[model samples]
Target: MDDNLKKLIPFALKYKPNIIWNVVFNVLYALFSSLGFVMIIPVMNVLFGEEEKVTKLPTYNGIWELKTYLNDTLYYYVNYLTEQKGAAYALYLIISIIIIIFLLKNLFGFLGLQHLMKLKTGVLRDFREKMYAKIVDLPVSYYSEKRKGDVMARILGDVNEVQNSFFAVLELIVKEPLTIIITLGIMFSISWKLTLFVFIFIPISGLIISKIGKSLKSQSARAQQENGYMISVVEETLTGLKVVKGYNAETYFKNLFTASVNRLYILTNKIGKKHNLASPMSEFLGIATIAVLLIYGGTLVLQDGSLSGGAFIGYIGMAYNILTPAKAISKASYQVKNGSAAAERVFEIIETPNVIRDTEKSIAINSFNDKIQLKNITFSYDGEQNVLKNFSLDIPKGKTVALVGQSGSGKSTIANLLMRFYDVENGTITLNGTNIKDIQLFALREQLGLVTQDSIMFNGSIADNVRIGKLNATDEDVIAALKIANAYEFVQHLPDGINTNIGDGGGKLSGGQKQRISIARAVLKNPPIMVLDEATSALDTESERLVQDALEKMMQNRTSVVIAHRLSTIQKADVIVVMNRGEIAEQGTHDELLAKNGTYAKLVSLQSFES
Candidate 1:
């Protein structure tokens, strides 16, 4: 609890100016409200026809006399108004005072909320932006181990909860304490004996309410986690819907989804029950205290006649006012505890250390020179076993090198390392004698193009998707790139050509079309280095041929790294490397590997038989 409070203080302090203004308005509001209650005393005396004389003037020490002076000034004003306009007009003046107090109360309330809205929205926006930036900058290994939907839920839902719940704390900070202080001051002035009783009831009620809020943090955390799981289930089902349908796994997925929903349902109900109990419990405690006060105050008035009917009635009003702020404090306590749970989740992502941070001395490379050297490089996704052990390779500028290997063989790891998605555990990968680690990541990636086996397309027009390769590319440039990638014919056939809207994930396009669009995108980038990770592996024979042609054209003159399972695709490569397990077992032209009858020859024979 202390840690959570500590975390919240910084965010709260960030908007201190707004909070100070909010506090100022809240103080004014409480002052007016308390003043309204006290004004009832004088108004009652007037109604009873008692002479409005100061039998006992309130005295003070030092500058404390200022309050008494203000009171006397107001009294003289009321007396003058009465003499000029009679008691009826005096009553009208008193009513006007009450109206002014209420008006000021609402005015200050509005001002407080205005500042609060600014603070809440600003914090929310900043939190979300920071969370997104952190998520993007994190190592790729982080996503591989964590659920995508869980991360999304933290960024969206949890952050929103923290915003709302934390804002509630701001309201309580001002309104609750101000109400308590003002109400106590008025009550003490009226009768310190009665005020002491009210104070005694407050702490007792607070103690009980605090106990209820104790469990809120843990319950809220569990509820948030369950929500993440539910989102994860939905995300997985959507992304794998095609596979699920093809395998007739509807019932299987249904059960999986149902389980997630059930867990979320149960946890949600628990959280709702816990949170909802706060209001009613606090209300019941307040009502009980009010009943006790009524009984106690009535007995005192009846026995001694020291307290008047009017004073007692006015006291009841002040007591009831105390209940409102007390209830709000209790509710706000519960909200803050629940918000702390959400804040914890959000802060975790925002504060996550970037494992792949660039060095301060890293330079930005505008162009590639010489060769990309991988000298004795070794790596592991999980640090237990090396994926590329003692691997040495040199990719020269303006040459294409294809790596052929079975699944789990270090083919993709090479691409991953080249792009600096993961740094090598040992050895140096250098470009033009400068270690890749010495280069800024963005500048390095900007110089490279990647076309994966599964070409991902976003929901947008053909032109919009192509333009992602280079943000400033013109329509003419997009068209020329499409032509080079052999995508112009199919794109022209679309109902709206370059303006045609692709559905979500390019669902409107066939596999072949998506691959061509991806190729067109790469062609537009025109990077000095290109990586083709089995670009045509997922396509049909006809689609594969077209995409392969596009890929070949895009690879021209670029330092290309191709990971291919199809031997025919790399038969004419400048060099062919065959990997077995994590080690390169063979390297040469395709003919050389086949002639040697090594792993590459066996792979070729196996693929031919399967085809």
Candidate 2:
């Protein structure tokens, strides 16, 4: 909890003005609220014939003597009102003063809440922005071991919980303590003996509330984690809905989702019971203190005449006022405990160090001058076995190289390593004769363009999707790029042309259409190096032909590495490399490999037979 609290310090300091306003208004609110109750003492005095008469108004005095001066001044005013106006008018005047004081109390309370609202939402905004930046910067392999749904839950669900709970911490620190202190001060002024008696019961109630709060923290953590698991289930189901329906496995996923939800329900029920206990227990303790005070103070009033009836009743009012804030303090203890667990989860992602980061000594690369080299590289996704073992390749500038192989033969792995999605476990990859590890990541990626089989797209207008390649691209640049990728004709026929909205994941478009738009995006980037990873493998025959033509245009005069399963796609490559079991098996131009009758020749023959 202490560690989690440290994470909130920077956010708190960022909004210090709001913090100061919250504190200032809360103090003023508490002062005004207690004054409302204290004002009742004079009203009661007048009503019960206990008012002290005064012949003259009190003179102004220094701060030290202000209390006495104010008391005498009020009685003097009441006496003057009684003489000038009737007693009924004097009573009306006192009632009017009490109403005005209570009104000011509520006004300040509202202002305090306004400041609290600012702090609550500002902190949430800051946390969300930081979470997004961190997730984008994290290495690709980090997601392999993590669930996307869980990360989503932390960013959306967990951050909301922290916002609510953290505010309780702020309220516990500022509002409740200030209110309790102000109320207690008035109670002490009325009767020190009774005030001390009330203090004794407080510690006992606090100990019990604290005990309940401890259990709440653990249960809250469990519930939040289960929520993440449940969200993951939903996200996975949605993403794989086509597969689930095709396989007739909807029931299987339903059961999995239900199991996650059921665990959350049971844990939350326990948390609810423990959390609800704080209010009633504190309420009961407050009533018990009032009962004890009534008996003891009542004796002094009746037997010894030491306390007046109106003043005694007003003192009881002040003591009762402490109950609401005490209950709030108790409830806040549980909330802060609950929020601490969530804060820890939120900070976990925020504080996670990105394994792939630019070191201070790293230099920036802006162009592809010579070639991209992978020299005797040994790499692994898991530590157990290499995906590319002692493999090497060079992609010279303005030339095309193709990698053909059976699945899991280090074809896609080459793309992953070159992009530094995962760095090599052994050997080196260099660009322009300089090691990639020594180059700033942004600079390295900026010089390359990638279009993959999935054709991932966001929900936005066609122009918005294409403009991602170059953020400042104009309408003419987008149109030219779309024409280059053969996407402009179809885009022009759409209802809104380039402004047409693509549904989620580009669901509104056909698979090949989506691929062309992706190519268009890559074309706009116009990087010196292009990576086409199975770009047209998923398209139909006609779509493949059209997309293949666009790929040829995009690859021209660029350093291109094409990973293709289709033999027809890479027939014109300058070099064709065949891989098997994480090692290079054959290398030559397509026809040269065919003449050599190596692995590449066999792969070509098999494809020819299939065709």
What would the TM-scores of all predictions be? 0.94, 0.96
TM-score of 2: 0.96
lDDT of 2 by residue, 1-611 (tens): 35686578788788899899989999988898788788788778778877778878888879888777888898888888877996778889988998998898889889989988988888889989988999999999999999999999999998888888878878888888898898887788778888998889889989988877777878888998999999999999988888999999999999999999999999998988988898999999999999999999998778877777877888888888889999999988887877888888888888888878899988998789899999999988989888889998888999999999999999999988888899898899999999999999999999889988789999999999999999999999999999988889899999999999999889899988898899999999999999999988778888788878988878888899999999899988999989998999989897788888778878878877332
Please provide, for model 1 over 234-303, each residue's C-alpha lDDT reduced to its tens digit, 9 standing for 90 to 100.
Answer: 8988888899899999999899879878887887787777678877887787778778878878877788
RMSD of each: 2.5, 1.9
Residue pairs with backbone atoms closer than 3 Å in model 2 (clashes):
none
lDDT of 2: 0.88
In candidate 1, stretches whose alpha carbon ends up further than 4 angstroms from where it belongs are 5-17, 50-52, 55-62, 70-84, 609-611
lDDT against the true structure, each candidate? 0.83, 0.88
How accurate locally is residue 508 in candidate 1, as Cα lDDT from 0 to 100?
A: 92
* Alpha carbon deviation, residue 512, candidate 1 (Å): 1.3
lDDT of 1 at 276: 83
How big is the positional error of residue 293 in model 1, measured in Å on the Cα after superposition? 2.3
